[model samples]
Target: MKIALIGAGEVALCLATEFCKSEDEVVVLTSTVKPSLKDLKAEIRLTDYSVENLKKNLDDCDAVVSTLSGPNEFYISAHSNILEACRQSRKCKHFIPSEWNINIEDFPDQPMFSAATHEVVRNKLRSQNDIKWTMICHGWFMEYLLPTKKNPLREIGLAWAMNHGTKVFDMYADGLQKVTLTSTADAARAVLAVLRDSINTGADLPPVTHLAGQTLTYRDLFQLIRTRDPAWKSNPVTFVEVLTAIHEGLKANDALVAIHQMRIMGFTNANHNPKGKALEWGTGILQGLRATSVEEFLDQSEAGEDK
Candidate 1:
């Protein structure tokens, strides 16, 4: 399919990477469009952030996927520019807006719900009657659970960034809370799938299809880590203190509710299934990369205090 992708962020790059692998023609638009899809080796058309240039380029594409990050200053503006261009393009059929996080309707009043603004943009596109739209509502990215250079796991024994000594949050199920979390690759693949066939796809207007590597809590994750490393253990904390901290932070508008809802919902939906063969394909490539217990994650390098 002839596709035009907006924004060259992680999500956009990842999706473009997968779609390119599928041998589809993709055009990536960013502040400065790279010659080819970076790191993916696909023949991607590149365009800078020029509305006039994009309109002419996208005039013949079958679908347009907006992986633009949002609810922020630049993201909103860029999408608005893209929306107007798309409205006049006359050849685009499906417009997949950028909504890779929580369900927008779940928290209509919160600005962090990024979905709200996306809905507004989507409505604008649909009103033209020339473009159909689909929204991809994925839960938290499972990859977030694993530690990265920016978000390293807590040391081995002491609490890491968590309030109190609690290893897990309250919104999590009491014991066995099973929530789905899609791997970044899986999420990208699912978006590509929706782009391929927007007409007969997932759920309603939001096109709500949840994806995940697996449905397991922090405890489940801890257990997996323990199974891999017998030296790991837990340092428990109270739910009240953590929730109070979160409430205080968000109530003061110091923090957004996106993270709060992620813990609360804990990927709880069970009926959602992952689409796109590539999502599954990528999961296998990145599997077995994590095996650290919460205790070790928090205090492994801290004061070496796991007790």
Candidate 2:
């Protein structure tokens, strides 16, 4: 299918890369006024991403997938413009907004990471007669916990989370929550699968989709890392320390602010846990890696293959 993807960040890049691998004609829409599409593998189009130009682009496409982000100010503005443009064009079959994160409904009181504007846009799109929409709500990225080429959290041989070698915090509960996580590749594949499936037509949509390598706590992750690397077994970070920092940050009304303050910039659960039964996806990422004890995550982070 010919699909137009909005933005060109990590998630967008991952999605476009997957679709291109599957032989889908993917067009990346940029508002750079005059974007240099030279190295981009996907077909490139330039527009201000304004409502008017967006309509023109949609006229030539079957669907639109937005990887636009809410935290990035410019991306959020462009997302709004795209919504308006999609509404005016009235040609797109499916519009997937950038929502691959913790479910908003899962957290009724926390506003730290909710996409308010995107939700509004989604509501407006659903109410319209011309377009069909679906939101991707995969939990946190598993790589966020590990070191990556893009994520510089792992430096010299160490990575950091809310805890600093003492505290045990849950991705959902107090070191017991079983939240879902997905690899960059698998998550993208799932989105493409839905887009390619003819069954996801019209207003009716899949109620929810969950992806994960395994459902375990931070302690479990620590154990995995330790089992992989021997160094982490000695001075491992504890859940108590991690939870204490998060609670203190929340008490100060600066939990989100803390993300910026940390040296390693990545998103993970603070303290509150997700409710209800979660379906697990992606058990392949954890196959050869062994970190079943507190000594595991630290050891593996220092000695395991750089995932």
What tens-digit string does per-residue lDDT give for candidate 2 at 1-307? 7789887666676667767776777888876623334555688877776778888887777778887765556556676677677667656656777766555445422334344555555566556655556666655555555544443222322223433333332232234434455555556666666666632443354433444434556556656655554445433344455456667767889645444323111233422124343332322322232212223433454565556
Number of the top-ranking candidate, with lDDT as the measure:
2
RMSD of 1: 8.2
Q: Which predicted model would earn the best TM-score?
A: 2
Q: Score candidate 1 by TM-score against the native.
A: 0.65
The TM-score between candidate 2 and the true structure equals 0.68
RMSD in angstroms, all models? 8.2, 7.0
lDDT (10s digit) by residue, model 1, range 128-246: 65566655555445444444432322232212212223333333434354444555555555665655545445322333444444545556666765665565555444455446756
